[model samples]
Target: MSTTPRARVGRPRATAGSTQLAPRDEILDAAAALFVENGFAATTTRAIAERIGIRQASLYYHFAGKDDILVELLERTVRPSVEFAKTLREDPSLASAAALHTLAVRDVETLAAAPHNIGTLYLLPEANRDRFDGFRASRRELRDAYGAFAMDAATDALRATWTLAELGAAIIHLVEIVIPLRRDGEMIDAVRIADACLRLCGLDDAAIAAATGR
Candidate 1:
């Protein structure tokens, strides 16, 4: 009953060989990849089975259906974000803030893009409100940890700064401008974005190359 789907950290557990998939494991992996790509609305169980080189009947040998796949994939992607947030909460020192900022920016970006379809599926109003019901505390903990991180950054910035909410909203607003353009096959002015983000935290770029690789 292994749940990992990939060979990497936090990835779903996968079968050793491609020849014969463990029924349940094969179905979960295929279904996860599909739902993360095409989303729940357009993907089919048949397609999932075919992706794993198995018959449709083989798929049903494990999963209840598509919804089960979608639910599991969502959990797999978001749970790590919650876990990462905990570390930020525990340490709010200057060094901790710098490290958290760098990691959080990269990790959250990866998480957001990992399953392109996951974002939109969960974005449906009311549909995702309770999606993390049992994981509610983790979500709150992540949020509080982020706020604490932001406050530490603001303290460095001086100017008696606005509330962490305002600073965060403002920073995210700037990022929203560049993300869509990058996805549209345009090169992002990553330097400019990183510069602006660092400035908000009262940090100057010795060379954003190190912190952001920009």
Candidate 2:
């Protein structure tokens, strides 16, 4: 007699109707929504799996666990700004005011383009843990980019009274708080926000207008 075939083990592949996305992407999308809607601490792997109509074990096919999903989402939220900030730092030809304006506009646009307000994840206590060190490092790079522009704008001792660190923090505030709060429906006027950010960095009206081409 022929032996019966051994039953397949482990989570089955995701069905097309359950998610049109490739399994990994579908899991990331679901995890991002849940992390944004319900704080990261509160969002479980099972909930993420359920959101995409997959078994909890299937989530492991894409991610090791909830923390892996969260770290990936945070990286997606911040990596573009980090990469662009590096470019600005390397390009000596870019003027201080122009660099600041360019960074502000691009950073705000990246934030608005995300599927959810992933920036909000920065507030989660879990984000401070060692596992999220990459996210912290990326943010610091962006902050340092802002500091460089601030220092460049301070051409004289009198003008440099405000610390570069303080000026940099102000720019971060504009991107993280002001622009999002001031959005017109789903659209954020990145140019307008960038102009405001330059003004915060102590650039006069003419300078702001010139840098932003407005």
Candidate 3:
């Protein structure tokens, strides 16, 4: 006798409704929210799957485990700005002050627009673990880009007082203040922060306006 073929089973529908994202993106988005709200160590793969309304096993199709998800999320927070910094560095027409302003504004926008203020994850104690070393390195690259632009834009007086590392660290610190502002539900002005960076580099009002294209 001929036997009937078994019906093909498909992935289950997400309980979180139609997020309209691919499975991988859906997993990342869900994981970011859970990681930001619940803390990385406290968040389990099962919980991330539940939040997305998928099987815990299904999450594995896109990620090796919770650590993989966390790594990707952390990288997501910095990757765009880092890439933009590279682009700005290569261009010949952009002046250093203007370039710095542009990078700072773009970086601020990147931090502010992250879903659920995901940059706050940087503060997680678990983020210091070895697995996150790659993320730390990427952040340092971004910091160096900031420093280079700041140095190029710096006045003689500013340059005399601070080292390149100090200027870069200070600019990064200024931009990152947006994280706390976002976490507190305060409004952020990306251009304003960019202007602050220009000022920190010792640009006067006219110079800042020119850099800002105002």
Q: What is the TM-score of each candidate against the true structure?
A: 0.57, 0.87, 0.92
lDDT of 1 by residue, 133-183 (tens): 644444344545545555665544452756765655555445444435544
Lowest lDDT 10-residue stretch of candidate 3 = 9-18
lDDT: worst 10-residue window of model 2: 178-187
Quote the lDDT for 110 in model 1. Answer: 45
Over 4 Å off in model 1, which ranges? 1-29, 36-38, 55-62, 91-96, 105-109, 112-117, 125-141, 156-196, 202-214
Query: Model 3, which residues run further than 4 Å from truth?
Result: 2-17
TM-score of model 3 (CA atoms): 0.92
- Candidate 2 vs. true structure, TM-score: 0.87
Candidate RMSDs in Å, in order, are 9.2, 2.6, 2.1
lDDT, model 1:
0.55
> Candidate 1: deviation at residue 166, Å?
5.0
Q: Please name the candidate that would achieve the greatest lDDT relative to the true structure.
A: 3
What local lDDT does model 2 show for residue 136? 85
What does candidate 3's lDDT look like per residue over 1-214, in tens digits? 9999998787544556448888898888888888888888888999988887888878877788988887888888799999999999899999999988999999999888887788888877878989999999999999889999999999999999998889998999899999999988899999899999999999999999987779
- Model 1: lowest-lDDT 10 consecutive positions: 8-17
